[model samples]
Target chain A: MTSLWPIERIGFYEGQASAFYNVSAIERDYFEMWYFDNLGAYKSAAHGNLEGVEQGHRKMEAALESIGNKAREIRDISETERKAGIEPEPSGLWQTGAYTDYNREHN
Target chain B: MAAAVIYRIRYIVCLLSMLSLAVHTALANEIPAQGPFTDSECVSCHSDRNPELIRQWRNGPHDPASGVGCSSCHGSLHADANVKARKNQGCTNCHEGPASHSYSKSKHGVLNRIEAHEQDWRKPLKSGNYRAPGSAYCHLHDGDHDDTMSADRGPEVRQWICVGCHSPRYVREQFANGRRQLDIADLKLTEGKQLIASAANSQTKELSKLRQSLIYHRRNVLYGVGHQSPDYQWWHGQPALDGDLIRIRDAIE
Candidate 1:
């Protein structure tokens, strides 16, 4: 009778994945800058810049932790809903008349 | 009026807190990472644990005053008690100049293809071949790191390092052969110069110059200096140059 999955859960997971992607992008940039620093040019400034990047990394780690916590909360709530025999509502995109018609035409 | 004053005081306190936080963040970013280990810590631990190595390092040219410590050559990133990480690049990192440049071209450098950063020192000695001396063996022979005495003595000290692989007799023989070569080079240079003087044509002038250069080449002075081999300098180098000059002169005549 009740839906286990929240409509917003997909967006929440997407947001978490995006945060991780951002962290990966930042890490790649940090590594590149670190290699450039090792080449002996802009040595002093590069050191300071690396320190800044490390701080940014810590911030990203905190954000990831926050996202992880949110994911756990969602999981717990979904588990509770599942135990109650509530089925997840179908996605609106899949349930749409246009999607059904497209599938029919492809078939 | 009292409420207004209290509100203003709270605003000022909040502003100060924010300013402090900004300053702290800026300071954190500006500070470089203090390496995991300090020189004093390294010395203190190794002094008793590896007394011999510590003693060698202490006596050697790479004292703390020289701005070179254990980590300067060995690197600080390695785990504690990791001596195998010591590299030749550590020497070249600071000693990059003509002398170091020449060493790279010397027989030792060419044969070993001396990469300062390579961990070849850790490998067991290759049998049946002259394992050309690396920077470590040459400078730190028998744990006599004190180069102050050696520096004053010059190439003689280097000769001591050389004798580890090359016997005194062998060196003497090589020197004798080198002298003979020098004589030959001189005779040719002298004859060439005589021929050039007689003709004085552009072709003869060029030939004379080539002969003179050949004489210089025979001297092997730069090669000796680069190798830090005194025998090579006097017996092989200077005499060879002098001989080449004679040879060119003779050739011209």
Candidate 2:
């Protein structure tokens, strides 16, 4: 029968075989075949737990995206302000708590 | 005349309850005027609560000199002592430093604030109990569900986690106090993760080596993330397993 085992699966099967069984070649092949079938089951189970980790990663990504979007928007707004011939750059960058927030960039 | 007497009695009851409440608040905020019991009472219980903290305290330049106890940080008042006074006033009183600062900003403290409105804030802490290895209290051994917090059920397991960074004498003391078991592998993973977190948070030359070691540590990836390994790997005579050895090597060095 053809095996659907990938390279990673084959390596892991070898380790599992070495750890669990030290029988004849036929026995090793039988265990490897069993593991090959079981891999699908384990992968499905693992996906259940990975859902939360994936969600956490998405949240972190969202935070990064918001930061990037805000910076770009600020730059565009400043450029527009400059073209209008008002105060060269908007003082919003240096106003009030902006200086304290700037210090956050240094460390 | 009788109506005035009833009103006066009601006023007295309100005043007494108010006085009782003020006294409770004072007791909660008041520092212990005397040192804790020198006996192993603190260690006996706390060694079970947080053997890891006990281990750190033993070697952490406090044992031989001033001899800190569980009360030094968590305070001595039991839950039954007073309502709100049982929450650890001692640690906040003196350790207004980095750990306290970081902890206040941590998710645990935020959760604590939310829970403070409904439940007794000092329930577990007042009962000489500490949150377990994978508790939401810290990022040390946090597992799948972030909401549930569990403590080490075994005294030996608790002590074993402590001996990772503590001195031999302190380890022995902890072991004497119902902590006979030991596990180097578990301690290595727990401390290694904390080391990594500390290194990542603080940028200092002193933590550079720890950061390097933490970055390269292979077992860290699979240590708490998976099932069945941490428990059996320490107890059963199993060969050392590395989950992401190659990935860790590439990431670190």
Candidate 3:
């Protein structure tokens, strides 16, 4: 019979995959939505609405500043969890993108 | 006199185009001619037949204000709307920009580039169905047809859409943090702007460099924040803005 009390599971934690997955997605969507919204505004300004063009550009900048920090925060938290050896479920979010620094400091 | 003649011709061209569109629409709506959808005929016929599509459109960001109709996105061809939506060509017809570069940088884009055909696209455009939210999912409100762009307004109104995949609390917290960071970046921008204005010599190469630095800061802010791109914000965003401020101050000196 297989022992239910499994010790020293893969990836240092049982839920590591899930926690990483959520963090990966959170960072990614933050970037993706920003891309989508930024383009939408550019298209709007390009099509017309020159009056709001300057403000529109400023708003886009503000959003980037905000999202970049958010992504970093998420990455750091996940890294901390990894260090702590706390695990999540067994799903995965593709750890990609330079913005999220997903590959930073990994063994 | 030559300019006046050109203006006159342009005015006549506009009038004729409007007249042709009006005639085309009138025939489509009144004559009940059965063929490919011409103008607003899809809406006219579907208003009674389907009603839901029309209702969704009426409530969405498009329709009367956007001047976009069924034919605009779905095209005049008698193809399936679901099939048309699986790809982004319909939305991209009008919403073009450099956002693709950001998307391509993402792993999602990289994955799609390699194995997009592996996706079960026939499953329809909805939240739980697709591996990820495509352009239609975001813009069309998960097949709502209302064209509700929740992300445009911000997280307060549309975090529900994200709740499909993420915890609401996590998303809200991220949005709040993002807002705060943006405020801080704006302050940096204000300082840079003042420095640029106060600089004594506007025509000097130093002043020109300052002007160029300000533009870069704006670009960094947008690319950095909008894409959540650490490559931009960490390397080029806050740090670059700090660098720009240094550049501006040096120029003033």
Q: Using TM-score as the measure, which candidate wins? A: 3
Evaluate candidate 3 and give its CAPRI docking class based on DockQ: incorrect
Per-residue CA lDDT of model 1 for B1-253, tens digit only, reads 9999999999999999999999989977652343567778778866866787777677666766777876666566444223433244556778775456556666777655644345345543222223666554566554354552255667556555556578877655554444444444444344434444545563765565755565555445444543655445444444334334333333333
DockQ (0 to 1) for model 2 = 0.02
Number of backbone collisions per candidate = 37, 1, 9
Chain A TM-score compared with the true chain A, each model in order: 0.39, 0.32, 0.44
Candidate 1, lDDT over the whole model = 0.51
> What TM-score does candidate 2 reach?
0.22
In the range B1-253, model 3's lDDT, one tens digit per residue, is 9999999999999999999999999977764643577657677777887688788788777766788876777667655656676665566576654344444444444554566677776676666776655567555665677745544566554566656666888767655555544554565566666656665766688777767776666566555544445455444455455455544554564
lDDT value, residue A63 of candidate 2: 49
Chain B structural similarity (TM-score) per candidate: 0.47, 0.26, 0.62
Looking at candidate 3 chain B, the ten consecutive residues that score lowest on lDDT are: B97-106
* Cα deviation of B12, candidate 2, in Å: 28
Q: Which ten residues in a row have the lowest lDDT in candidate 1 chain B?
A: B78-87
Summarize candidate 2's per-residue lDDT along B50-89 as a digit string, tens digits.
6766675565434535665545544454433333223333
Native contact fraction per model: 0.00, 0.00, 0.00
How far does residue A79 in candidate 2 sit from its true spot (Å)?
42
